[model samples]
Target: MQLQKLLSLIRQAVDRYNMIAEGDKIAVGVSGGKDSLTLLYALKKLSQFYPKHFTVCAICVDLGYDNTDFTGIDEFCRNLDVPLTLISTQIGKIVMEERKESNPCSLCAKLRKGALVDEAVRLGCTRIAYAHHKDDFVETMLMSMIFQGKFYAFPPVTLFEDKNLRVIRPLMLVEESQVKGFVKRQEFPVLKSPCPIDGTTKRAYAKELVAQLQREHPGTKERLFHAITEGKIEDWALPGV
Candidate 1:
């Protein structure tokens, strides 16, 4: 999980998907979590000699929670020489308090991403990088299958044609475990999530189930990831045929 290994995996995903272009500006959606922070660091390092000559900045959508500090994240970006734009919204109040959603994750995510995409557009960014690693991919596929009766997971690259923006997942090849180890090794500051049901969501259940399956049947996680990449699922294939 050192910087070298992290960059190697990131470069692999970026190359495989044709994610970056010359002089492209990418806005990294910084959630101030370990995964996002790791992505910020990895992309900053990669930009140093990526051969594509793309620039990176960070955009954080603050959910308007009280006593939630972003000073550490501000300093982290400053040290990395990356500009950070924070979009503040009352999403927390609207979704959790006013709406009182029984299932709030869906609406909350929609609002947050909408806010993030708007800011990226305002900043003239050509693409946005989300910190969705391998575990998230697997867990989301499981969720889609169990909840929606479909074998679906988001692709590594998605284009918002109307907005003229592309969403890329450079960390798609990295695992959650490697992200944790990278954060620990680098002593990066990780902010605690302000969500009331942070670890009690359906995604958490899938993560736990995946872990249990891995414990009972080794290589289960790897096989699942491989299947998603090679299973001919729509939008899951590489860039070219």
Candidate 2:
């Protein structure tokens, strides 16, 4: 079932980004969302059949929510034999108390990402895997072009300045709908975000725009993904030949 899709994604990421090696310890950042949870489950399933000598551990950053309980995540990881590390941080408090701003996603994301990177390095992980799939990349591309006037999006793989950790997106080839379908089929446990501004955010607007475009133009998503993978940026530098 999903094993095939999971394997295909892993293989595509490996071929595209050279993500895995003979022996690598990869740390997956899980936020208990559909994307991160699906990624962790897929990676755990793929680990059994993958020939690479690598391992995966799930890391969750609890952003200081009093009512947020991680029991579901803990049970899921335990059943899958995957170790889960939950780090408690005062991100929510900081965002709500200190930041006198309407939008909190930017600040909260930056702090959480910094914490994740530091934790990955401290855990001796060579690679940090995220669950940014095709839809996320597409939304980012659209956002950059429309707002920032730049034709840039998140890359599949990037190396940090320290040269000790490599950031990789294994689900870059997977679609958001596919991941949701997989989750529904598997009946995976999902925890709703406890953030104060979860759905009413700018990213949600970008998501809605893309969804509308996708509805109007069938196969638009696939075409955009192909453009990303097949287009040649270097050709822009050359003169008309």
lDDT of the candidates, in the order given: 0.93, 0.81
lDDT of 1 by residue, 39-100 (tens): 99999999999988989999999999999999999999999999999888999999999999
- Give the C-alpha lDDT of model 2: 0.81
Best by TM-score: 1
The candidate that wins on lDDT is 1
Count: clashes, candidate 2? 0
Query: Estimated TM-score per prediction?
Result: 0.98, 0.91
Clashes (candidate 1): 0
> Which regions of candidate 1 deviate over 4 angstroms?
237-241
Candidate 2 residue 49 C-alpha distance from true site, Å = 2.3
| Structure candidate 1, residue pairs in collision | none
Q: What TM-score does candidate 2 get on C-alpha atoms?
A: 0.91
TM-score: model 1 vs. ground truth: 0.98
